[model samples]
Target: MSMGVGIGRREITGMVVGAVVLALLPMVVQDSYYRHLLIMVFIYGIVASSWDLSLGYAGIFNFGHMALFGIGLYTYGLATTLLGISPWIALLAGGVLAALAAALISLPILRLKGIYVVLVTFAFGQLVVQLIISQSDYTGGNQGLVRIPSFHIPGHNLMRDHKLGFYYIALILLCCSTVFLRLMVRSRLGLAIRALRDNEEYATSRGISISRQRLITMAGSAVFTGLAGAFYGAYFRNASTDVFGASLTTLLLSMVLLGGISTIYGSLLAALLLTIFSEMIAGLGAWRPIVIGVLIILVMLAYPGGLYGAIAAAARALRRLGRRQASP
Candidate 1:
């Protein structure tokens, strides 16, 4: 019981430290250019965290997550632009559509094991991108859509170009997303997700309804990631296949793996760290992917559990040192 309590306390401590760092970000870094980068970090942070829901928790490797994310982007944009709906309503619609899309896709694919799930979802993601390109009538085809409506929060305008407003709005979503996901991890459903991830057959034998849990996890991930997609569309004032492309999916997957798979704060830390690295190494341009790939390889070879596991190990070592010092 005390060990469990210690773990919870550690999670809270890490989250608080993260929040503090984010709050002090604008103050330490006054440049608007870098501020824009911070907003992007927060934006991608949402998608990465959402990805962790299934891939991390449910032991389900889904590579087509960006498809649901793209659906959210296109769904909200088309619904609002075509039907003349409000942005907020469109946002809700985007999330709902994303969840529905996950459900529709997961019905058949969720039954498959790890590698099969990856392949199927990857195909689905590719299909969504292709369909968007083929149907120029609705999606503007290869030309993509420009100047989609920006984010509006009651009185404030949350445009990506507007550094301060964008930061605050994104921070709210980022914090809320983290808290909500953490609670789910602590809840009954969270336990089920872990169980399903560890051993689907065993979980099913225990009457855990692995299929139902997979669908729920997929839909839940889709909803938040879809919101993230909507936000990305609004931020850039545009929506395109490239934004929801396989590249984004792969990068997000790295954030999960390189940070620590199945760990709640894993994606958040990875997103922030990678964003900062990208800024520092912008001159690498397209070769950035290669660098990221190499880094991931090195991390996996050196630390099996990624960054969080390394941190945990270090914390344990420090605790041991303190205990030894206090010994009579």
Candidate 2:
């Protein structure tokens, strides 16, 4: 009990320190280029972490997670640009639409298991991309939606020129997302989701509604991911077909895998590391993807449980070694 309490305290301390560092990051790093990279990190971090809620925790093979994100992106962009809605309201609308999309998709696909779920969800992602391309006029098709809009208040709308403002926004969003996910994973609902993941039949026998739990998890995950997507569109001032691309879905999956499945914060850490690594290799031209692919493969093979699991294992080994040395 004492050891468990100590571990809890350490975790809390680490989280507090991390929050402080992230909050002050913009103040210390004024470089626009690095700031932009960090923004991407936060955005992808949220998306990846939320994706884990369903994929890792609920055991839902949701390959179309990115599709919900893309839906949010397009919805927010269209609402703000076409209908001339406020940015704040548009952001909320994006989350709502994303949740709705998740619910709608979950209705049919939730019944599926194993590879069937994966295939249907994967197809859903592709379907979204093709639909956007087919409806060129509204979606901008292959050209994509350019000059959508940037985050702005009524009077102080300097986010276009100043990256600092956007950095803070991203930071706050990431923090909120982290807290929300953490709370969710600790809640009773989270337990039910995990139980379903570990033993679906057993969980169902215990009176847990698998469909209800999974649908709720899907909606929750989609909300955060959709918000990230909306932020991506607004910050970059564009909504491209690439937002719905499989490449992004692949990248997000790699982050979750490399970070450790069911480890929410691990996904965030992995997102930050991977995003920075990608930016560093951006000058590698065509060789970037090849290098990233190799790195991911190596990490997956070497650390089957991911970086987080690997680190934890190393720590435990060290402790055991210390205990042996201290023995009389």
Best by TM-score: 2
Tell me each candidate's TM-score: 0.86, 0.92
Error of 2 at 82 (Å): 1.7
Per-residue lDDT of model 1, residues 258-296, tens digit only: 778787677888998987886787789888777877777
Clashing pairs in 2: none
Please name the candidate that would achieve the greatest lDDT relative to the true structure. Answer: 2
| lDDT on C-alpha atoms for all candidate structures | 0.80, 0.85
Q: For model 1, name the residue pairs that clash.
A: 136-141
